[model samples]
Target chain A: MIHFFNDIARTRLTRWVFGWLFLVLLYQWSANLMISQLESPVLLRVDLDLTYWLVHLTGIGEFFRSSYFAAFSFDFFLTVLCLVAVLFPKRTIVPILTGLFFLIYCVLLNSYQCWHYHNLITLILLIVPFCFRSLKTFSILFAGLRYAVAYIYASAAIWKLVRGSVFNEGQMKWLIQHNYVDRLAVEGYELNFLENMMFQLSNYSTLSSIALIIGVAMEASFLIAFFTRKFDRHLIIIGVVFHLITAVLVDVSFLQLWILFLVFLPPDRITSSPTTWFQRQKA
Target chain B: MNFFLRDVWKQSKIVFAFFVAFILGTIWCTFSKIEITPFFLWAHYSDKQTPTGKFERIYIKVNGEILDLPKFSRATREMIQLPTEYFVQLERTDYNTNTRQLIQKKFASMMSQKSLQKMEGHLCNSKEDKNAYLYWMAKYIERVTGKRVLTLEVGTCELLFKPDGTVARENFIFVAKFSRA
Candidate 1:
């Protein structure tokens, strides 16, 4: 961070963070205009949505039309502005002016939800070019982030294999038992042979008992993949594959964000052409 | 120098606190009360209705022949009202304050079997005809060899007859559930 104040990161951090923030903001604003219901059931995953409401609650209810639109925009827009103040680095996480704007937006919006994937990832990408300036803090912070990502993956895998999910009779059966989707897909209500076979096999005491063993193995391996040196590539490849299948069948977008975390590691994590888990694990 | 306000965003605490507050407040507003409206619609399956009375047979004139038959039926007719409970049949063995009328009516109707004259019949399809027929049956008697109908205000059931007091026809016991105007 100290080095960032000097010539080390003055130009890089400012350009990177601000550019990403502005570009994303531009896209979101335009998209929001076209689809009017973007805010109702909350079509987008926005953490600072409360700002939209404070515009209605306080006396300045018509804030969107006049009183507070600029102020509201500045809440996030100024976070981007902090990249400019990064040059000063006067014992400030971000500069004072940017901070004041954030404060006003926070008070008005009352936004409490902490940073989710969108904010965190975008912020990281914006700051990465500057991170090289402080190798020690940069390495340690990146390591911690890497561990956090691994934890998220392990938790997800654990949650899935719990009594109701992949390891047990509950979720698989819940999926097969529902007739509505099958009916829609096939023009009539009938469980496919593959699904039925899975159901019957799952119900057997022998199969259910084995599933618990397999589940523990998968979850443990997914967690260990990040820490272990010997089988890191093998384990990570398997974890990524499992994640892809989960994304397709269960439709959880947050987990897709998780796949990005694995990319944070040194290129040696997989030793291949930098992508595609489908190919054999080389590194 | 406006140190605190100017430098507040530098404090993870203020940012943290504000961020937390903002998230929670937004959730609270999102979860606020939603209005629910009440609704009503018409229903199905109505019941039969009649009035109340207790009377016995004074004479026995069957098939236009005078006979010394005392096996009589004293029927009761209770008027139709909203939300009736149940139809009751009682004998001396089971008679109580509430059921005494049913018991007495049962015995009197049994012992006072006298004259019965069949009138014009009713079709089963129409609801109006069913109520009218049940009401009219309370006024007169009909012994069509196979069926004996005993109906009044509360409910309708049938009694079968043999010379020695045995049921000869299938008895239909109907407890009407609802009555629509």
Candidate 2:
């Protein structure tokens, strides 16, 4: 087992990963997605998830929801842990603890919001490879994570294919109408350019169908990563474009999941000097 | 495949085991329609959608002023909209009694009666749940908008796309009001 602390390259890459993860956390905090900002929510939506039910039954959920002090304290502790992990990326325990706390945060936030916010799944899982300090172990786990991200997109495309929704001409039109009709209908409310374009597209079935097919094709392209790493850069571009289109048209922001794209960056490139990073990308 | 089985197993048995377990668990969850977090089905937007002639819209009025949800940030907007929509949906279904019954009937052979009852208790909504949700929602609104919510009204209305490329509100399903003391 190669010690990551002794390897400057792996250490630098780990720090780079943690730095971006911290920035994502800071953005989430600013967006009021943090527990302190949520205050102490009284209601917990357990849904059908057995793990959630266990949390509710064990009084752990109640402990967080019933006391703002407890919730805020946990949030502060989690932030501190994440900061420590970012600073000392060589410490194996810090990332492990941060990952565990982040899991609890994801579950609690979803319970409070009464919705299963799955976009955070990428962020949560991406923290796992950093928990290992063994260079070989970290590399293998990181490779697994890369495959997992590709699987997410590829499986989504497969689902659409299996469910026969890919062939439905009205699918995209209905989705746009369902998402934007209320906003467009609100009198005196100004519609932005993207919203206007989406509304116009909703009225035209052919245009919307073409957009949906393009989306499916983009998702399907992730399958290429499983076969070869040569097209990883192209996959990253497609992933970003896909998420951007969804954000603009459906108002769903999966930008946080973009952190997973870091996996596509070769470890050597990540470990390279920061000033040369842009130059390397251009090359 | 040979490299994975030989080298990965030799280097780290734990990582090898974890990969195997996660792959199997994800496959099972995907096929069984169960999501045990981290092992999601990833079947989002997979089902076909068709126009129902009307779109149901949730409207929230805080301190007698209706909220333009599109004006807020995505996170804030979801924080406000998701719970309100869920609450209204539960109200329509009588706090999920219908859902509970269906679950009980479907899983009768799979789960014990006591376990099913406990699940029902956790899943079902009550008047107290509604009150708690309202209180938390009011506080969240206050925190986000920096306005003390004196009165909050949540309602749902149907929106119809007219022939002339315009949308009109058809009729309100219901409206619930609450006041913070």
Candidate 3:
């Protein structure tokens, strides 16, 4: 059964779903998060990023923290150039992909206290590197960070679900309403149109409930995506669009950070086709 | 002093030296938490006066990339959590270019259309009708920024700095635009 599992439907679906995410999403994610952090109370307010304050104050920051980001950026920049130089070889691309995710994890642990979505993506990014045999350094870092992101994603999603927040239609409405109304389009700010959509939609609680259900689906799908790249790819787009909708409408700005993992894996590959795989298994 | 040095040596000395460097880097140098806080202040007050100049985020496409740079928000700083600072498209053309024609035009158009869109509304609500709209944005920003025209290739959001560099524009989203080198 396991041997027969590999098929075009699964592969193609997976490829279609995840392609843009795994290739194009990582840089934006890190850029979004790092930029956001740079503008945070911890960094901008106190004049210290996580590396400067957290890691340095605690332990790792002493040597690897301060110039780490700068060096890492330079390193990443070089790796990318090399990839371009080599005409995007999988060998070169994969290693760099793996390393970038590992770096994301280090940055997150250093900066924020909570294991937020930022941490989760950082973790997810390291998976491919772990799978590569010859690249031990990349593998080790990937394994550690992947575990971190997976753990954080699961824990947080569960927490939000349990609190009646993630699934609550009323809360979702509040989020929508809070984001919409006169405050939303206030003087032509961002998300003005999204605010308009939410406002128009929120008048009916039933529609509001559907929006809530969409949220649940999105959160639930996020978990599934982690295990399977197809779902991950599809959901990353949904997640980003949703966040973009919200960010514009409500002022949340972590779209790239939240969906960073779409960068690795065959985003368009599917594990199986619902009908064909099922029929074959049945036969 | 000898005893202290010896203690330092006992702990991973390599680790300890690195630690000191980290501390000095954080403590000695300074950075700023920049958002559109000042921009908001400007917009809110200007809204009270000029009626059309309130802080805002406008979406535009450079070449073909869709962009959104939210420069407005309603929440006060203390009431918010997480990094609201956005990772947006960067600006190119050497700081303030005196001769970037396309850029200046795009900027002006954005400044104007920002009014037509909501405070940070959908990035590209109507894609097909945007050529004239975009050209106008570049035209206006160029008009406002300077005289000479410059060919440009950078994606950046407007940043409003406080005199002291504390809060940036709050309650808004940063845009995303792929930069081409």
Candidate 4:
């Protein structure tokens, strides 16, 4: 088992995958750490995670005291270790340690009820080391990652359809007024292009209908990959454009989703492009 | 320590089946409206439907002074950084507390009688509840302003919209308050 895993880890594709996961973790962790540092420290420091509860559960709750500083320090250390593990993948055990530390971090976040669905992508990273042990396992895990992406979109589209009025012009107006405007008003910001567009299109049923249809189609586009991988790039492009449009229209940013979509881009394609270009230039 | 790839292939098949089942179950649950544990895959599908066209302003006070809580303010920006629903729910739960009521009264005392009269809704209804929200706010303000806050207050400035694009603006009205317990 050890030999099989080490052999697979040495591969260029496995290295590239780990590198991508590391980047995602680094970006997310660093951004979160920075923001938390700048924010009001009031109850934030007092907020306890599972580690605290676990200590208490074992009858040592008195001895296992934790504060915000402990949580912040642990997370910051894990973030640094994750980057180090990626850089020194030759120490295969380091990557595993990074994954384990991250799992612990996730547990702590959950204790605070702060865990979100997107955090599951980190679970994929945790399994990466184990999954790459052999060709068959690698294939299964790769496909599983792709399925996770598709599931996110399909489920979102289904929920919207269930809501029934998401396609209506009035629905668009409600969204703009209640969410975007109310939020912006609190922050003393003016409307942006997306808000302006929603306002103008709110009274036009036909245009709103077209916009709604396009949104659903874009979200559900990943379903095509389930049938065949023929149009993966097109699917990814559509997803990117959709997210970018939403980022502008509403203050909500799905930047992490963009990173997850990289699973659709074959590692060889990404790795080979720079080498192939250099070879052509040399020729 | 090399193993036969055939064994790996068989194991992979089981894993693949598990993935398929999980994905299918999630989709099925969405349609069936069945309760799912952990709720890690909601995809932000909650309806965002709300009446538009009204302008609103939320204000925050620490101690006796009102602070800039507009979008550019660090405190407001950080609070909104949480999920939209979570932020709103936190406010709803936090505002109806004993310390918040004291802060609300402090806000009323600071305001002119005419301004207090114009204020609509019960800011703090002399109700005594838990002090968790106030403690949190004091801690928050101490961190932001680098001083221990003795009291805090919150207010909202609302503007009602007319059909003709005209707005009837209301000045700052007390919403809730927090004080050190």
List fnat, each candidate: 0.00, 0.59, 0.00, 0.18
Q: Which numbered prediction scores highest in DockQ against the true structure?
A: 2
Span of 10 residues, lowest total lDDT, candidate 3 chain B: B37-46
Q: Runs in model 3 with CA error above 4 Å?
A: A1-120, A123-131, A134-157, A166-169, A180-194, A221-283, B1-69, B72-181
- The segments of candidate 1 whose C-alpha lies over 4 angstroms from its true place after superposition are A1-68, A71-133, A160-166, A175-217, A225-227, A255-259, A262-264, A267-283, B1-181
lDDT of 4 by residue, A1-283 (tens): 1012223334544455456656755655443422234232212110122233342234221111234465556557666765665566455565566666555544333322222334333454424534334455655565556656766776667667767655655665554444444444333445567666656665675766677677777887777766666787787888888887666444455664465676576544554557785886799
Pairs in clash, predicted candidate 4: A42-B139, A42-B140, A177-B52, A187-B71, B100-B177
Q: Is candidate 1 or candidate 2 better by TM-score?
A: 2
**Candidate 3 local Cα displacement, residue A94, angstroms:** 7.2
User: Could you say which candidate leads in TM-score?
Assistant: 2
Residue A144 Cα positional deviation in candidate 2, in Å, after optimal superposition: 0.7
lDDT of 3 by residue, B81-108 (tens): 2222211111221212221232345455
**Candidate 2 residue-wise lDDT, B1-181, digit = tens:** 3344455687779888998898898998888887777787788888988876588788888898777787778787888898898888777776755446656778778999898777665555666677777777888888888889998888997889888767788677655788967
In model 3, what is the error at residue B108, expressed in angstroms?
A: 58
Every model's DockQ: 0.01, 0.52, 0.02, 0.13
lDDT of 3 by residue, A145-234 (tens): 322343333444454555555545455545554444223333444444545566556556677667656654554555553354435346
Question: What TM-score does each of the candidates earn?
Answer: 0.34, 0.89, 0.38, 0.67
Per-model B-chain TM-score: 0.17, 0.77, 0.23, 0.46
Give the C-alpha miss distance for residue B12 in model 1, angstroms: 19
Q: Any idea how many clashes model 1 has?
A: 24
Chain A TM-score for candidate 2 is: 0.90
